[model samples]
Target: MDQGLAGLIGAVVGITGALGAAYLAGRGQREQWRVQLRRDTYGQFLARTKRAERAGKAVRLAMDSGRFEPGLYATFAAAVAEAEESLALVLLEGPWSVASSAEDVVRHLDGWRWVVELWYDGDGTLTLERALESAGRDEDRFTQELEQFTNEVRRLLHGRDHTLTARLAYRLAARHSA
Candidate 1:
């Protein structure tokens, strides 16, 4: 082979290798950015959900006291609305499983709001005790859904290996309970 042709081939290979490396690096960076964005959105949704839960508790407290505090209900409603807005982002940034869990969480928040409304309306049907009980159940369901969402987020950011480990642990616990 000619020396000039050999030099040209070597240059071509070196340039191609550099370009490939750069492309891979850029792709990795983009993926990292996407993960960060999802993480931030998930955190925001959780924060809003917590705020709404706190507001819901306040409404329940007023009900327990036998007071019709519209302001408390309004605050709770506003918090729920904000959480829902955060949920919109979660849905947009979702892997479907995470979005579904978030939706469930929001649904429970809405259910709690409904219970509060029914109590406030006072149609002589819903007693304060029942309303409180319903709220407690809703809170429990919300907590379960939140944990599922967190697990899903972890799986998404980490990998399927984490999910497998979690499933194995859950099965072991269930077996022990049985």
Candidate 2:
């Protein structure tokens, strides 16, 4: 992903995890939930992160070349699948307490689906400038949404007293440059 989006997302991780983040809170202790959520959230992060990188790479390829050809939808499909699976896990595992702004995640999924539909119509004929504009707009919107959701999650997670998992996330996040 571009530095703008990457920085945006890194900040978001701290912000969202603390926003009463959606968590599987059945009979487990809060720490347990936090630990599990840390892992799950990281997995979700990796999937979306890769998707962002792939989309950015595809755009660059198209821009560098003369034609609009790079598997946009195919890459987006992986992101869609990750989001769907996360939702499913949230639904199936326990009563998911939604953090504020995560509803936007669902909205992003819808927007991505629209992007896929646009791609299905044949991007070869689409103007490269127009296509890039569309992609940049979509990426901006979704990244904003993801940033907000992540801020919420960070808020929820970091608001509590430090636990092993929380400290681990903190250390890991600290290891990176802003």
Candidate 3:
């Protein structure tokens, strides 16, 4: 090949490679940002839920055992409210499945709250023991849903496609794994 032609071809190849690398790097950075956002959102959600759970447990323990702790109910109520508010973050940053799971968790929180209010006195048909049992079950369900949501977020972070088709495939695979 002519020297000039060879040099020109080499320059074009170099420029193309550089542009391709830049494009790939930009894509990688974008993915990283998405992963970080998800991590932060999930972390906040987990923290809020844990706070609410702990408070709820304390109140339930007091109610069930007839302790009548002065601030337990108030603390639990505040924590539950905080947890509910944190759902906005999940809704904003999370995938639909995660948002749905978070919503389910919030529903369980509401149920737990209702049980605490209705039967905390131990006078209703719903006894304190029954309420406690119900709360335990609700917690179990919430935990499971939270686990699934967390797993979904992890999968997304690890480069699982976020398209609906990919979600269906992932869910199906997850079901098989389970």
Candidate 4:
């Protein structure tokens, strides 16, 4: 073969290899960005839901104590609204399973809110004990749904290594709490 032809062929191969590598690297980076985006969205949703749960607890406690604190109820309603807003993002970033679980959590929160509203407006028709019991059931279901959502997120983010991811997440949570 001619020397010039040989050099041209070598250059073409090198250029092709470089281009392929660059393309692969770009693809990897884009995937990483997407995963990060999803993680952020999921975290926001979880945080908002937790806030709503805490607010609900506060409202329930006040109600149980025979205190009709309208401010607490307002706070709880605001928190639930924030959580619902976050749910839209979760749904947008979801793989269906995670979104579905998130939806369940929101639904339970909404149910709890309705229970609170009914109890407040019951005017003695709805007993406090009955309302508390209903709220407890709603909370339990919400917690289970939240756990399912977390598991789905872990499976999606960490694939088959969810146990390891769970441990890491726990550690991070513990660290942050401290």
* TM-scores of all candidate predictions against the true structure: 0.85, 0.52, 0.74, 0.89
Cα RMSD, each candidate: 5.7, 19.7, 7.4, 3.1
Candidate 3: tens digits of C-alpha lDDT, residues 1-178: 9999999999999999999999999999998888788888887877787777777877766876789575777787788888888899989886888888788888887678767777755567987678788888886776566566656665666656445554465456445533
Give the TM-score (vs. native) of candidate 1.
0.85
For each candidate in the order shown, give its overall lDDT on alpha carbons: 0.84, 0.55, 0.75, 0.87
**Clash pairs for candidate 3:** none
**Model 2 lDDT tens row, 32-96:** 76667765864575365445435544644555465544465556566666665565544443324
Off by over 4 Å in 3: 119-130, 158-178
Least lDDT summed over 10 consecutive residues: which range in candidate 1? Answer: 169-178
What's the lDDT of the predicted structure labeled candidate 3?
0.75
Indicate the residue-level lDDT of 137 in model 4. 97
| Cα error of candidate 2 at position 172, Å | 13
Clashing residue pair totals per candidate (backbone < 3 A): 0, 19, 0, 0
Runs off by more than 4 Å, candidate 4: 122-124, 161-178
lDDT of 4 by residue, 1-178 (tens): 9999999999999999999999999999999999999999999998998889888988888888888698888898899999999999999888899899999999999999888888887687878899999998998888777777887898898885365555566457535633
lDDT score for residue 56 of model 1: 86
Winner of 1 and 3 under TM-score: 1
What 10-residue stretch in candidate 4 is worst by lDDT? 169-178
